[model samples]
Target chain A: MNINEIRNAARRNAGHVRRTPLLTSPFLDEIAGRQVYVKPECLQHTGSFKYRGAHNAISQLTTEQREFGVIAFSSGNHAQGIALAARQNQTPATIVMPSDAPQLKIDNTRALGAEVVLYDRESGDRDAIGAALAEERQLTLIKPFDNEAVIAGQGTIGLELANQAREEGIRNAQVLVPCGGGGLTAGVALALEHDAPDLTVHPVEPTGFDDVARSLHSDRIEANAQRTGSICDAIITPSPGQLTFPIMRRLCGAGIVVPDEDCLRAMAQAFTRLKLVIEPGGAIALAAALFHRHQIKGDAVIVVVSGGNVDAPVFTDALNRFA
Target chain B: MNINEIRNAARRNAGHVRRTPLLTSPFLDEIAGRQVYVKPECLQHTGSFKYRGAHNAISQLTTEQREFGVIAFSSGNHAQGIALAARQNQTPATIVMPSDAPQLKIDNTRALGAEVVLYDRESGDRDAIGAALAEERQLTLIKPFDNEAVIAGQGTIGLELANQAREEGIRNAQVLVPCGGGGLTAGVALALEHDAPDLTVHPVEPTGFDDVARSLHSDRIEANAQRTGSICDAIITPSPGQLTFPIMRRLCGAGIVVPDEDCLRAMAQAFTRLKLVIEPGGAIALAAALFHRHQIKGDAVIVVVSGGNVDAPVFTDALNRFA
Candidate 1:
């Protein structure tokens, strides 16, 4: 997608989405050895940046398409985002979720007035089930990240960051974004490329799920060997998206991978120092900024905290174990 | 302090202090039975609104006074605030803290380049020690909340809220502020009284320490029988400040008292829903908004989360126990 498409998406979701804050902490800055500004998308609706993409994609549907309703499949955050967005638009939504998804996410999706269909992650193909259901119901399928509209919606965060940096008189900045299927990273890179060319964007991923990092290095798509066991479940996609990898390969400077331990430490630090509840996946970029500070080149660094839909027990474990 | 002084303080603190975001959650709104907007001063420098007052007080010092340095006595947040503010102005700060203060607060204050003198809270008089140090060192004494400049600085939050609400097209709102010495409540009330007269401000206090509530009703200063206790140690002042009481009496509509359990619940809610790590004292106003919503009036309500400096163990307890 182009910068104009992203700008149009931003305008479309102006009042619908929250203008989340770009927060800073002296402690985090000291740890990172740079001025660190955190764009906490954990504070976004549905406790994730997925809301922006979901709202943007769903809001652009034709009258007839909207009347036919929408269906999507996700483990957590994306499901809640699409469910909430559909509910807001007075459209019926059917979300196909993994049976092992966090109970809170499932409950929240249902609470948002969506019909939830649960399938086994190991035994069932989520895509096949979702497609069959959508076909039967004549419902439009909303992809989590690969779609053009969704990418444009996620790019609004890049536009916001550029504007926020300008307001603070920061000309050049290094931005680290959490990469799953690479949609968010690619979208932000495209926006920054167009709006703030001086700013460099990098993708940060959990160690085992470093497909985007591998893809960027090899200049092609790459897949993870295993993904079912990572603590950062939210961004544990098996590989980078087809549509997203190209933009990221073309625009992003490099990729950074942080271990799970560092992600837990980052989550704890975010809670104690920044007073922000960041999930493990969301804290990957921050972890890279803090632990891999020597590798990043910038006076001002922006870390994107992507989501906070973690379970309570898991969060408690991270906080206590890391501490 | 009048609105003009507060306006000047806001101007002075424009770049020095963070313009913290006023966050909102639909779930919180559902709980509060109104549109609830949260002014999370926990995200402020030093993890509390105390930074605003301390910076305002210390920044206004003359060259001679600044060279002489400053002294203050606080159990927690204010100590860190003054320490950081003094260090920023190139002034040495001597903080007389109770020996029983949170270890994190003590470490943070010392890390910010301040001298810490710890005394027993139950036996030694903090005020006497602080006064003696200030006198002996020829240093100005920065009262935690009672000074005019400090009150003006805290009033900046009120100014910010009014401006933010206006930007959101909200004309009338109900503001709930946690009252310790009544400085924050009074300062915010004064600003709202001048800028948004239709907005009513109320003081929210822990159940046993509802001295401000009683004082307002009786038209006189009142004291909490028990001190050196309560999980909300950040705002466990024995009574309302002499300078702050009159303003609160004049402008604040009423007061709300919430139990400690409610505060813990609010803290957990803030963590889960708002992705905000709020201390028990900081969550008191939010508790009032959520649990005591029937007592408050207006279509829109503003809850000021005053601080987030709880010990890790304490926070974990709140999260696990409340959840």
Candidate 2:
């Protein structure tokens, strides 16, 4: 909820969440004409920054709540994150997923010691099932982005980015964050705005699902018709959450929309030049900086690569399309 | 070189050599019934452990040698390592690469501010071209391995491994090292043998080019005149270098050979389970452990994932094959 709370949460979850290396790319620097640094969340536990929030939130739960178990509704990174967090906390977690979720994600979630409950999105809503399960079992429902603890946990990444920038001697630079439901962006903006106010914060989203950008433009929480075929499957949220959107609207400077092709190109560039494997959603900020270089300031830029839990076949296919 | 000298060299090059994470793998543990930890060299600069040795060797060059520049002959990670090291040292570098070397590798070397001289391996030897270039340009030839400076530099990985093992409370464990010209294995073995004498060290090689194994068995360097195609491009060296072979023979507790299929499987497992993009050569040690799980010591084990700079098409094909 607050910057200090986020910092404390991050400190508590330090050992659990990987302090993933913030790598500099000589090739990316040449392309952007700026000092480009990548915070690889792909290298994090469960292959995303979602692990940070999930772990931090789960770690701070009441013993009674943890004993009753936790419920999460996600078709991707959040499912795996909650699964892994529950496993680490020695608590049971039930993850509700759409039947059409990527098998890789399902398998990873199950592998991390979470019970998977699947529902068809066309026929039923997974959130309803998750809520029902929580009510029936008196389980604690962990909202992916709307909850205070979740936002605070995600904010830890911003704390890390600010520290990394300071350590790297980057006095003033823009931090690009990818927004799905604005959880990551809200957390990053909250930390940067409080501590490193001089550091500009940019939240990146896909063109089709640029609710954050729309909200910034209209000064209202704008919602679009639920749609899902973006290359960046992880950040395909139809709209920002009530809790996260307000924080993002206040703390974020501006939002940028990157094309699907830009996401593919950035994924390719990450694989080849940065020697990193980033999922499309994880690479949206990188894509923006690469293709939308004109929008960025020619100073030190830190891009938070949100996650890397991409299915191998899907990742290779993306690379092929870009190639 | 003595262990103390190599340790000092590693300490000197610590700032340049990334302290790659010793990643834990519960999946690997479940499969092998032994706690499996991976020392991720794939995440290192230049995408391999060669960077440590190359940078160590180049940085220690005398003022006269630095002015004259450096020359290296390799078609893989070593070329990129030397090129980047020389460039960072602000010294000119002429890399003599095979004409058929991966274009990506060539491009990366050139990008690092190295002048590449392509030579036809069929018509002439790469080492001969490198020798000529060094003589013509008055540059020092930085051998990929088989040199005291290079071995000392490569030993840094071993030092890091020791620290990682200590941090993880792994007092005694079996450590697997991928062997090519035996430079890496020799360095790692020397460091481990000296620092952690309780640790067991195993050298793994391709079934086709088990030069270190053969040399260790014969108690002398053995050249395999029969050149066979190895799926692992990085470890296709037909024979072990004289300098490295002796050290490997003295230090390695055992040697093992893994098939191409095992390497491919290991690479797939690494990509999917570990969320890492390790090249075939980098996955051989993992392959040896996974395929030879029955033979390895029934204790905690560490696998040195050597490098991750596979050609795009080849890597795609490998992923497809395993998929």
Q: What TM-score should be assigned to candidate 1? A: 0.98
Can you give the lDDT of residue B2 in candidate 2? 78
**Once superposed on the true structure, which residue ranges of model 1 sit more than 4 Å away at CA?**
none
Give the whole-model CA lDDT for all candidates, comma-separated: 0.88, 0.83
Fnat of candidate 2 is 0.36
Best-matching candidate per TM-score: 1
Task: Write one digit per residue (lDDT tens) for candidate 2, span A1-323.
Answer: 67888988888897777777778767888888888988888878787889888988899889999898999988679999999899889899999887777788899899888999998866787667877899998888888898888888888888888887777788778889888898888888898888788788889998888988998889898986666668777887878899988887787778899988788789888877766777878899998888888888857788989987777777787668764
Interface RMSD of each: 1.3, 1.8
Docking class of 2: medium
Which residue pairs collide in model 2, if any? none
lDDT of 1 by residue, A1-323 (tens): 78999999999899889888778878888999989999999989889999999999999999998898999888888898999899889899999988888887888889888999999877888889988999898999998888999899899999999888888777678899998898789889999998899889999988888999899999888999984777787788889898998899889988898888999899888887888888888999999999899879979898999998777777788778875
